[model samples]
Target: MIVAAWTVCAGTVMPAAADTDPRGYLTKMKAQEMWKVADGTGITVAVIDSGVKDIPGLEGRVLPGMSFMEPPFERPDVSYPPHEDFVGHGTTMTAGIVGDGSAGGPRGLAPGAKVLPIRTSVGTPMAFAVASEAAKGIRYAADNGAKVINLSIGMTQDWPMGKIKPAVEYAQSKGVLIFAAMGNEGEGNNWTNVIAALPGVLGVGAVDEDGQVMPFSSHGPDTDLSAPGGQVLNRCNGNKDWCVGDGGTSYATSLASASAALVWSAHPDWTANQVARVLIQTAGGPVDGAKRSDWVGYGAVRPRKVLLDHEGDPGVPDADPLASPAPAKAPTPSAEQTAAAPRRVESADAESGLSWQWPALGAVVALSLGITVLVKRRRR
Candidate 1:
């Protein structure tokens, strides 16, 4: 039941060129132009992670949310502002979705979207005891009007998929889009965590400014999309200044969620499946033919292509994008089966592990400065 936040930090400060726009991923993804069409005006994205802080960049955008952390660790109520970010991970994820960039602060992909923060213990000593909280959080978000649910955390221990399937099904049934991070374990085998492997979730991977899949980004069959995650900038804990060296599939998950918001806001009538289809079809990859790869899934998310050019066919609005014929009954994995799976390393910094070399592809590189990568450690 132990869960870990999937984020990494770069030890160095942001490069001088990144100062022009701390959130350079927006420009690279053509988000600025898309904003003219749709700025996620009426959407609400649920950030289910550690917790979201009410910073100036996020300001009034953060709504009251519930915390499953318990006792003195828990907040007042669901109406209470979730301003307790123990590791700054949730705040960074929130900034990726809703930062207004006012006063030269970090700008989000969906600056106009509202955030519903649901705090869970994704990276704490008590994480193992609160696994069911994630499932409850998803159901709560869907019932309370969350259009998109972003889970920037993953379980480090092997838990029964059944524990979360019902909640995931409930969210999908309510027309909510869910995105989870493909863990930052590279090819280390811990990347395809249970949440990422689920049928109804869109598993996201990380790519650098160059659009190259980061060496540390997880790769597996479950990865549904890729986004700018390497060396991305976000707010630091208890500080409004941008933390320039943070990167991981966690950031990519937030960006992908925001991209969904932009598309949904623009086409209010489109179903979650249709929005997902558009993202998959319009994604920019190494080659048009190689749209789905183990490394980057359906390729780098290009919301602008979907928003500006009105590209791609959003096939079957009501169809589930990740649906397979429902098994007679979903088979639950045995404890032994779960244990056999590669468990994530438990560490304070989840992405600071040994680097795996990935094949380099020639692509246009964008210069965006900001964070160091921290690797997560395994629980004993």
Candidate 2:
């Protein structure tokens, strides 16, 4: 069944983000053994979830973010006050990717990384009427200075690649890293689609502490890596100091994004694809990519190898992360892919100038993999 989509125009009446604890996301990610390399100091992670408040660990650190939710009619709906995290899900996800806050309990993989919250909803369907909303979020994140984007939710429908695909492509063009949950319905119905399966996205799956794939972790062809996403501790409501644990691909995706942050922060000169390649090449604890299972994709994420050993080459700097989606063929419900439709591209108010975030060594031509080198120069 398809859900009705709503519009969230800028002056609409929207609720504020919940102010409760949100540590569940981080602690679990760290416990999975992926934090050893995540320092994320120079990276900015865009968290598209319920809403993120200025909690203790995330205050002063989070920049102004946009709330794509619609409000009643008048009154400011800044996504901060009224909609506070009645459900601490978004905060937990955000914390997982980049939390340094003390009060929550668990710390993020990249303590120094910052977050740009895109207050979208997992509960209600909005302006996604045509799928432009997802694109809007992707573009907004890229244009604003977010080096990585994390989408932790999923829809129950299977729409073709129209607006959503391009939005992901555009973000990649601007050098943004996109990560989405593989889904938590592993043992259940296990239906998957959209943002998570898109060409440029990094589809993250969930695994347990035993390095075994969680029964509920969905097994789609899009899953790129398995990360700790089982029962783990995190922040939630009440007392604001208490912590709890839950498991889902959302947590796995968050940690994957943080892992990327650590590698990028360390090698600021590398492009998003280079960082991604380095990661896939060094991913941990042997599982067969050849005999791949429905549970674990590639393998459980082992980020320490990337930071400490740097075993593989960064490949071409301009290579597309999804350039070879051919390798990760996820099984679709229908043999036929939904019709591919082109869509709109929205510009964001955020700008990085690409300078403050990282230095440009002036290569005019970035390194390209699988091809002979051709020299090009932009004289300063």
Candidate 3:
């Protein structure tokens, strides 16, 4: 069952000379103010990427999830303790979602939230095979009780839309809020891949400490919001010390997912639609005649606004904020609609000033194993 698919790039990690204040992003995003109101106390976020390790920071916070990778591979074990982050990417994402700073490590936005670690990849070596099972992983998360699904992975080309749409719809139908990275090729086409561009998905872009969109953060009309991703610090696998200078829309997606968990935990009665609407309406963005910017999406996500301020209208509770107009009901599908391939362009990974050529396009999708990790001075 090795289906041809795109490779998954591990999130970039640049070592630092000194330990960054793990709460740096939370302070900048004003997450501390919102914590008084809610700390995502009753939420579960699904981390669909490389496996998550049971690190000290994530103790008692990670729930068991299934691994879709084939056996005897890079990450062979697939059992109850699905915490074996091979590339350190998924572990960082999980830490960003639910880390409680229990071990004097980096704290997450939603420290009270639990993480469902669904291993979909074994790092870049098996990216294509891992991507082939992404849709199934999404379905498994939704059915198993994930309130939010965090897909921090992306490809230059859209996965066959037909293969992904139903799974996305299924998750949305089950009241799951999905967030995905817009890609890190902002200097290039910045095309929002199919998964992020899907109607119900919340596509996230990266912003730096100064509240500016990163040059590498992908931009498109499908972008839903922006979050602190550039130079953010997170835990690395097998290391108690934190890794700084990590940048990409992948980290932004996890932060946004944690933001949703915060709001969902505060207002558990609100439907997924209401939560989505609140996030969009309250986001901090430019006012272009009340329209959102293609680069920064609706604006930088401010969970504080949604949690502390309770006066804004959340609009329809069941209506999707990103839904498109319905097509006329038809008994049969149109030939053109069924056969058309999505428009796509190729791009390279430009993280940390290093460039790598990706696999060529074809029926067989392959991802490049060019994850950039600069080993600078170690930070405690």
**Backbone clashes per model, in order?**
30, 24, 1
Minimum summed lDDT over a 10-residue window in model 2 is located at 354-363
**Each candidate's lDDT (Cα)?**
0.69, 0.56, 0.66
Over 4 Å off, model 2: 1-38, 72-84, 124-132, 235-242, 285-292, 321-380
Report the error of model 3 at residue 346, Å: 23
TM-score of every prediction relative to native:
0.79, 0.70, 0.79
Off by over 4 Å in 3: 1-22, 72-81, 102-104, 122-124, 235-241, 287-290, 324-380
lDDT of 3 by residue, 112-132 (tens): 899998886435445565555
Ranking by TM-score: 1, 3, 2
Candidate 3 lDDT for residue 152: 79
Tens-place lDDT per residue, model 1, 1-380, is: 24443554444445424643446677777777999999998999999887886667788888898776643335434332357776667888888899887644568899989999998755554454345778888999999989999988765334434567678889988999999887777745443555776666888988766576665677767777888886777555444456566457888899999999999999999898888877776676544344367777767777887789878677777776556332112222211111112234356334554343221111111124311122322111
The numbered model that scores best in lDDT is 1
The predicted structure with the larger lDDT, 1 or 3, is: 1
The candidate, 1 or 3, that scores higher on TM-score is: 1
Error of 2 at 126 (Å): 5.6
TM-score of 2: 0.70
- Give the range of the ten consecutive residues with the poorest summed lDDT in model 3: 330-339
